[model samples]
Target: MSNRVLKILVPIISIILGLFVGAIVMWMSGYDAINGYIALWHGIFGSSYSIGETIRQISPYILAGLAVAFAFRTGLFNIGVEGQLIVGWFAAAYVGMAFELPAFIHLPLALLAAAAAGALWGLIPGILKATLRVHEVIVTIMMNYIALHTVNALITTVSDGSYKIDRIQKTASLRSEFLSNLTDFSTLHYGILIALLMVVVMWFILEKTRTGYELKAVGFNDHASQYAGMNVNKNIVLSMVISGAFAGLGGAMEALGTFGNISKMGGFTGIGFDGIAVALLGANTPLGVIFGATLFGSLKYGANNMPNAAGVPVEIVSIVIALIIFFVASGYIIRVLLNRMNKKKEAK
Candidate 1:
């Protein structure tokens, strides 16, 4: 089969395999797998409120997936997206609370603060990799802890004594005023629109811009890029900065649109970590990320209903997601088996 066909078939097959495995797990645990699945579907697609919640969940995933996907394209493993997200959340929240500007200025300013904070967080590992010849993975991992503790301390000591940031200014919050009728007061906001716009922007930058070419070239081969007069170091740093910006924006969207505040003790939310899965599942493409985010969002929203309806554990959803990722990543084994079966048939 052609690579393109394989690409299309692999994820579909993996999803089927994952569902089968999940069913087996449910059966072993004394639950009716079919009922569990039905509950999941009902939660995700049954009502307008469910659908809106799914979309809200997907908004952050879209941006976080883009962050990881963009870094992957540059051959960088950005494990620090979690840290960047925390920094962005705090920055946006702080800015939102500190300012008293009009809605237009406050909202943009908060978002910009988030992007800047995330970019700065990303820059640390980028600089370490560029100047000190350190591996980005190592630096980013360390930075995650730094970000977590720093944010925790800031929230605990700097502002309100609580573990959460103050509620954002009304003007800074992103509301679904226009879509209120459709969403039924779900916290689904304009962040979804922003995420979609960023996807288009990312696609355009990666496919049609010179900087994108340079970043990809460096990722493919730093030595070759250097020989070809590409600034490999600069590209590496720039790629991380851009990746962090995406993640930061994701944090901003979540803080202002959904949470309306930043948590202190929780530090980096798992959204950044989940982004890695989303990026891999999407094959690191803009369109792929959107689909991956949608699937994840649906599963997450659906899982909430399973516990109430079918006596199934919500954690099963994570297991199913893990199974899907595992199967997809190991698709070559499936391909080899299929090829061998085909060869035997031809010989017969």
Candidate 2:
């Protein structure tokens, strides 16, 4: 088979294998695996409310996934997306609360603040990596801690000992007028639209822009790119800045649309970490990230209902997601199995 064919087949086979393995594990643990899966499906797609919830949950995943995917295209591992996201969250929230402008100006301004904050956060690691020869992975990890503590401290100061910030102004908040009937007045907002728009924008940027070509070239081979007259260091830094902006936007969506305010001691949420898996599963592409985020969001939303109905732990969702990533990452095993089966058929 051609390499392209193998690439296509491997992930499908790996998913099947992962599901089978997950079923076996669930069965051995004394759970009715079939019922568990049914419950999960029901929770994710059974009703309009469930579907809306799934979309809401995955909205941030899309942006976070895009952030990681963008960085991957530049051959950079962005572990600090969590930190960048936090900073963006706070920056957007603070701006939303501090301002009193019309929605047209207020909303866009808040989002822009988020992007800028995230971009600045990402620039730190990019500069460190480009000029100081520091590894991006290490720098990003450290930046996560700094962002968390810094946000936490800022939140406490703003809240005057309270944990949560005051409700965001109406103009800056994201509301869902279209899905009010489906959500039963749930907090699910219009941020999903923003995320979807970003998916398209990212696709255009990566597929149609010259800067994207430079970024891709650097990712393919930095030494070769430099030899070919590309500004490798600048591209590296620019990639991080763009990636950080995406992550920041993700955070802003969550803050303005979902939470409505920032919280002190705002912990490092796993959304950013989960983005790594999402990007990998999607092969670091815009459309792939959307599909991957949807799958993950469905799993997360469904898992929340499982603990109540199936007497199973919601944490199992994480395990399943991890298994999926593991299988995909080692997809050569699936290719080998397929090759063996084809050879057996020929022999027969």
Tell me the alpha-carbon RMSD of every candidate: 1.7, 1.8
Any runs in candidate 2 off by more than 4 Å, and if so which? 2-5, 339-348
As a whole number from 0 to 100, the lDDT of residue 98 in candidate 1 is 79
Model 1 misses residue 307 by how many Å? 0.5
**Residue pairs in collision within model 1:** none
- How would you encode candidate 1's per-residue C-alpha lDDT over 1-348 as one tens digit per residue? 566766677777888999999999999989999999999999999888888889999988999999999999998999988889888988888888878999999999999999999999999999999999899999998998999998888887756587676889999998767665687767788899999999998999899999999999999999999999999999999999999999999989888898888776544578899889888888899998998899888998899999998999999988999999999899898778767776798899
User: Each model's TM-score, in the order given?
Assistant: 0.95, 0.95
Q: Model 2, 1-348: lDDT tens per residue?
A: 666677667666666766778777788888877888888889998877888788889999999999999999889999988899999999999999988999999999999999999999999999998898799999999999999999888888888888878878989998766675667665678989999999998888878999988899999899999999999889999999999999999999888998989887536888899899888878888988998899888888898877787876776666777788899899777778878888898899
